[model samples]
Target: MKDLGMNLALSAEEKSLLELITPELVKIGKDRSKLIPILQLIQEKLAYLPGEAIHMVADHLSISPSEVYGVATFYNQFRFNPPGRNPVKVCLGTACHVKGGDIILENFERKLDIKEGQTTPDREFSIERVACVGCCALAPVTVVGQTVHGHMQPSKVEGLVLRARIEREKQQREKQKNESSE
Candidate 1:
């Protein structure tokens, strides 16, 4: 894998992902018909279809990059970029909207200093709006990683953001301490 010369050394996860994608691509065969299946397999493994992965898929299918991307764009399930370390998703389903979900979304954007669909410069977090998260009863919900905060109000967003920041800082400090000790 190092001999492939992509310049940047592949992370452990990246190397494992490549190993997973390579065989599946081969087993499925290199045809246009397998494009979506290939994309699905990649997304299932990585939660997103990266640029290099897209190029590899195109090459395998004997299709142009535009064609591969065109098919992927038609599907909303596909994400082109990797998710942030902490993904913050605001629900915009009908129930949530009636409960001021839009306001909650705006509050997140303002606090994070990045609009929806964008990650912070430090890549500590990302913000996205989703149609539903199966918590309609808990309208105006915001999900950060695996934790859900329901009945969110614009005024309460600061606390949520601040708590996440504090928790992440603590984790970082602990990690540094452990590494230094080692």
Candidate 2:
């Protein structure tokens, strides 16, 4: 819903994200050296940069849009498009792979109706593969949100997705409650 091509008024969500980072942003002044922090703040706020936001940030910080976009593109953590509510990361380390992590990943793809690096149609979930998470002692680990489930079996995919969906709903409810109070 963000039009990345135009300079427009900030939405409520955009303003909330800005507010969350204002303290850190205030520490940064007009110097171009702050470009990295500015980009980082934006990325952390929205998970990605709306093309229009790049220009907005550049103007606010007195820098170049090209510079903002360059930094945005350079970082793997910064995405141009919006990501799903819950990003699912599956560890595929050598130990995990040997313990059937590959099958577990495939199981997730099938059950979630989305492939690795792709988000579901409803944008509820996004799946990704990680090289390692240093949890090899518990090989075959899958992380949904911040919860890590070790020694995963292919059959556990449905439950993992279900738990993620439930958590997202709970988070959404909490967000709505806070918004209503505001």
Candidate 3:
């Protein structure tokens, strides 16, 4: 793939990812209309859109990198950074707002030491604010992973963060145990 004059030096992992996705890119064809599909495919495989993948897509479609970035950013479904093992979504709907959802969100930020839309350095947790989680009756809600937590209070943030860490550690240990058995 052409670097488009960016002179990017891809690491071994990036090169491997590019190699894995190149065939799918070819099968999907290079029409401009396929840009979104190409990006989706890459994101599906990599869990996020990396800069190298963006440049490759731009080059493949004969489009500018800025154009690709514009489209990607326009859609909230695309994530530029890798998602954390545990995702925490704080709802800020009208009901949640009235119930102090903002405070709950801030508590999570302080406890996680990362702002909304960012993942922790260890990739353990990520926090984001959502307009609504459709659980207004359970206003002031935070959803960790797939589980919905209702009636959230600022005081609960530490417990929630701690639970997520414990869960992740347990999962890791299980994975390691399985690997050893194999």
Please name the candidate that would achieve the greatest TM-score relative to the true structure.
1
User: Please, what is the TM-score per model?
Assistant: 0.84, 0.62, 0.79
Of the two candidates 2 and 3, the one with more favorable TM-score, higher being better, is 3
Return the TM-score for candidate 1, rounded to 2 decimals: 0.84
CA lDDT scores, all candidates in order: 0.81, 0.75, 0.82
The lDDT leader among the candidates is: 3
Clashes of each: 0, 0, 0
- Model 1 segments beyond 4 Å from truth? 1-12
Residue lDDT tens for model 2, 19-42: 666566667777778777787777
* Model 3 agreement with the true structure over 1-182: per-residue lDDT tens digits: 21121222444775798788998888999789998988888888877777888889999999999999889888888876666778899999999999999999899999998778777777778787899989899888999989999999877889888877887789999999999999
Instruction: State which candidate, 1 or 3, has the greater TM-score.
Output: 1
Per-residue error (Å), model 2, residue 50 = 3.9
For candidate 1, write residues 33-131 as lDDT tens digits. 878888999989877776678788888988898888888877778776556788999999999999999999998899988777666766677788999
- Which stretches of model 3 miss by more than 4 angstroms? 1-18, 170-182
Clashes of 3: 0
